[model samples]
Target: MKTVAICSGKGGVGKTALACSIAAIIAGDQKRVLLFDGNLGLPNCDVYCGIEVGCTLGHIVRDGRELRDAVVPTKAGFDLISGGSGWKELAQLEGAEIDALVGDLMVLADTYDHVLIDCAPGVGNRVFPFLRASQGLMVVTTSEAASLMDGYALLKNAWDVNPSLTAGLVVNHVGSPAQGRGVASEVQGIVGQFLSQELEYWGSIRHDSLVARACAERRIFASAFPTAGPSQDLVDAANAIMGLGVEAEATEEISMLGRIKSVFGKKTEDSEDKAA
Candidate 1:
């Protein structure tokens, strides 16, 4: 099973957005998907999945309930286990408590083809164990300098803990093409030179109002507005993960050659008409 933890150093940088979207795409393709909302202090994956939950990871951790009891199904053909709202218990969990939670998490992880863990912003003690346990870490960041710096800090900490941990970077809420490429290049350079971490280049998502609208409505953007740019970008991001060719019918954005031909085709047509 492929376990991926989606984390960003700073809050509100589209970590959950990218995690849920990738999970949905994998599920849509008939892969067994399990998503754990590790952002225990601020749980929103449950809301995004539209599952009303009476129990969550909080119950399992604080009340000594079984992890199976906290599993909640969602409309997107996957199970969501919430991290719980109150983090009092999580903040003070002992080494034994962390070991127990990790043991339970492994059982759930074994049941799916892919497990996506949505981590809260930062590299706190609570977040460290989960990041280490994951198969690989996917760091989500924006073009903002603060976000990149924090992401770097997380990468550094992860490296210090284990130099062999596999990691990839994803730039979120990218405003323009230039900005996206710039951020990607900057991250790749740093990871390559100093940390020597493997940086998988997942493409960027343009900032769109639809993402906010869908979030406010407690729905996923992919299902709510599949035709939107963000949705298409999500699809591409998933395809990249699987190392599969992207669908030609999904969006107008295509290979560089295809784009050039279309532009020249339009120019040629205009010139022909003027000559005629």
Candidate 2:
């Protein structure tokens, strides 16, 4: 499966909602999609997708459950692996614990078409593994100054980890087309100037009452209001994400630990040539 890390350095940018929606859209296209909530500290993907928590990553680490055992099917047409809210240990997991989690996730590469990791806000032990292992990075941000700065920080952190990993931007809760493009432009300019990195404009989601209602009701917005403009925007964005092409590892036949390590310990020269 192609793993995509959906992240934002700052919270309240609607990252979880976008990830869940993208999963739902891709799953509808006869693709087996897995949405793994990587926000171990403040996981709310389950809440946004309107699914119940069963076992989570915590189960695998703390309870000795298999990775697949934590899979929960959502009505939105995709499978989900919740990060298990309220588990302080999960939020602070690092080193060997993080390795074990990534190793297990690598085992499911053949089971799904895509695995979208809804990453937690900020960087560090819990988030790095996912970003390193992913073939795609989707940075969710808003026109707000704080979200822009923090989102850029998250992208820069990812670049530091994997310089070849190009990221796409999705400006959420935009007030207007001008506002959305302006946000994308600001980030693009900053990245090009400071980081010398390219950022793709995946598109934007306008603020909508249905989205607010979905969050308030703990449901997926596209499923609740498929006809909404913002819902269509999400569909377009999901298509763009699916269109992203990544060079698959030729040697996935190695051991799970080896495979995960290959990604975690990869060098920039061994990865995509900083192209596209």
Task: Score each candidate by Cα lDDT.
Answer: 0.78, 0.84
On residues 1-276, what C-alpha lDDT tens digit does candidate 2 reach at each position? Answer: 678899988888888988988898898888899998888788778888877787877776687778899899999889999887788778778778887788788787569988898988888878888888887899998888888889888998998887777589999998876788888988899899998999989888999988888888998888888888888888867887677663234333446668677776675445555552
For candidate 1, the per-residue lDDT at 225 reads: 84
Q: What is the model-wide C-alpha lDDT for candidate 2?
A: 0.84
Residue-wise C-alpha lDDT for candidate 1, range 86-171, written one tens digit per residue: 66886567666776786788887888877788987998776777777776777888988899999999988877765655677778
lDDT of 2 at 215: 87
Clashing pairs in 2: 1-109
Question: In candidate 2, which residue ranges exceed 4 Å CA deviation?
Answer: 246-276
